[model samples]
Target: MYKVTVYVTYKDSVLDPQGEAVKGAVHRMGYDSVENIRIGKYFEIQVSKDEDDIEQVIEEICDKLLANVVMETYRYDIQEVEI
Candidate 1:
């Protein structure tokens, strides 16, 4: 078995409204040291395949379907899991 961790985040030029809201809240709560914040998504997938192959497939999926490369970036890592 393999476990995959996928992280999806906005591109540098993309606007992150949720992250901005969080930053505002943080500032209101007295954290003046906060500079900037960005919101992102996380996904965990279970796959039955060789690590290298699975990683390639997942990367393709991210590039083709799961993420918008112009506005967002995605990265994934795979780990073997004992059942």
Candidate 2:
């Protein structure tokens, strides 16, 4: 079995409204040392196949369907798991 983890986030040039809101809230709570913040998404997938090309297939899926390349950046890691 293999486990895949994906992280998706807005590009640096893009504005993150949710992150900004959280930052403002933190400041209102008397946390003045806080700096800029950014929000991201994470996904976990499990592939039952034992093929060697599974990683490649998962990458293709991330590029094509799972993530949007225009405004977001995505990275993934795959690891073999013991049953």
Candidate 3:
């Protein structure tokens, strides 16, 4: 079996309103030290070892469903597990 951890985030050129809002709230709460904040998504996927190419599978899924390639970017980490 394989375990995949995916992280999806807005592109650097894209504005992150949610992250901005949270940063504002943090400032109000007296945490001025914060420079900025970026909101993102995380996904965990499990695949059978029978999948000949785990990396390829993960990349396709991330491109199609896990992220919006135009405005967002994605990265993933994979680990093999004992069946």
Candidate 4:
């Protein structure tokens, strides 16, 4: 078994309007120390594939669909676990 952790976020060069709006709201709510905010997506996948193939499958899924390479970037970590 495998535990895959994926994080998808906008590239540093891209402007994240949603994150900015949230940051503004947070500041208004009395947390003025908040400087910057970049929102992201987190995914935890449980796969019952062979150990050797888990990494490849996760990478393919992230590159081809989960992340938009043009404007967003993603990183993942794969761990082997016995279920």
Candidate 5:
């Protein structure tokens, strides 16, 4: 079996309004040292051992579904597992 961890986030050029709002709230709560924040998505996927070309599969999934190519980017980690 294989375990995959995918992280999706906005491109650096994109503005994160939600993150900014949270940062503003934090500042109101007296956390003045907070500089910047960004929001992102995380996904965990399990693939069977019988699957072939795990990298290709992950790339296709990320490119087609998990991330917005125009505004967001993604990265993943894959690990072998007994399950």
Candidate 6:
């Protein structure tokens, strides 16, 4: 089996309003040291070992469904799993 961990986030050029709001809240709560924050999505996927071209599959999934290519970017890590 294979385990895939996907992280999707806004591109650096885009503004993250949610993250900014959270940071503002944190600052109000007396956390002045908090400099910046960015919100992102995490996905864990499991694939059978029988699948061919796991990397390609993951790339397509991310590009087509998980992330918006214009505003967001994604990265993934693949690990072999015993179960």
Candidate 1 colliding pairs: none
lDDT for residue 11 in candidate 5, whole number 0-100: 94
Give the residue spans of candidate 1 off by over 4 A.
50-52
Candidate 2 pairs with clashing backbones: none
- For candidate 4, the 10 contiguous residues with the lowest summed lDDT are 49-58
Across residues 1-83, which tens digit of lDDT does each residue of candidate 4 receive?
77889999999999999999999999999999999999999999999865567778888898898999899999999887887
Ten residues in sequence with the least summed lDDT for candidate 5: 74-83
Q: How would you encode candidate 5's per-residue C-alpha lDDT over 1-83 as one tens digit per residue?
A: 99999999999999999999999999999999999989999999999988999999999999999999899999999999984
Q: Candidate 3: where is the Cα deviation over 4 Å?
A: none
lDDT of 2 by residue, 42-74 (tens): 999898866779878887888898878888899
Give candidate 5 misplaced runs (Cα > 4 Å): none
Let me know the TM-score candidate 5 reaches against the reference structure. Answer: 0.96
Ranking by TM-score: 6, 3, 5, 4, 1, 2
lDDT of 3 by residue, 1-74 (tens): 99999999999999999999999999999999999999999999999989998999999999899999999999
After TM-score superposition, what is the CA distance of residue 6 in candidate 5 from its true location, in Å? 0.2
Residue 67 in candidate 5, Cα distance off native in Å:
0.4
Residue-level error in angstroms, candidate 4, position 36: 0.7
Residue 24 lDDT (model 2) = 98
Q: What is the TM-score of each candidate against the true structure?
A: 0.89, 0.88, 0.96, 0.90, 0.96, 0.97
Each prediction's whole-model lDDT (CA) = 0.88, 0.89, 0.96, 0.90, 0.95, 0.98
lDDT of 2: 0.89
Winner by TM-score:
6
Candidate 4 C-alpha error for residue 68, in Å:
0.5
Error of 1 at 68 (Å): 1.3
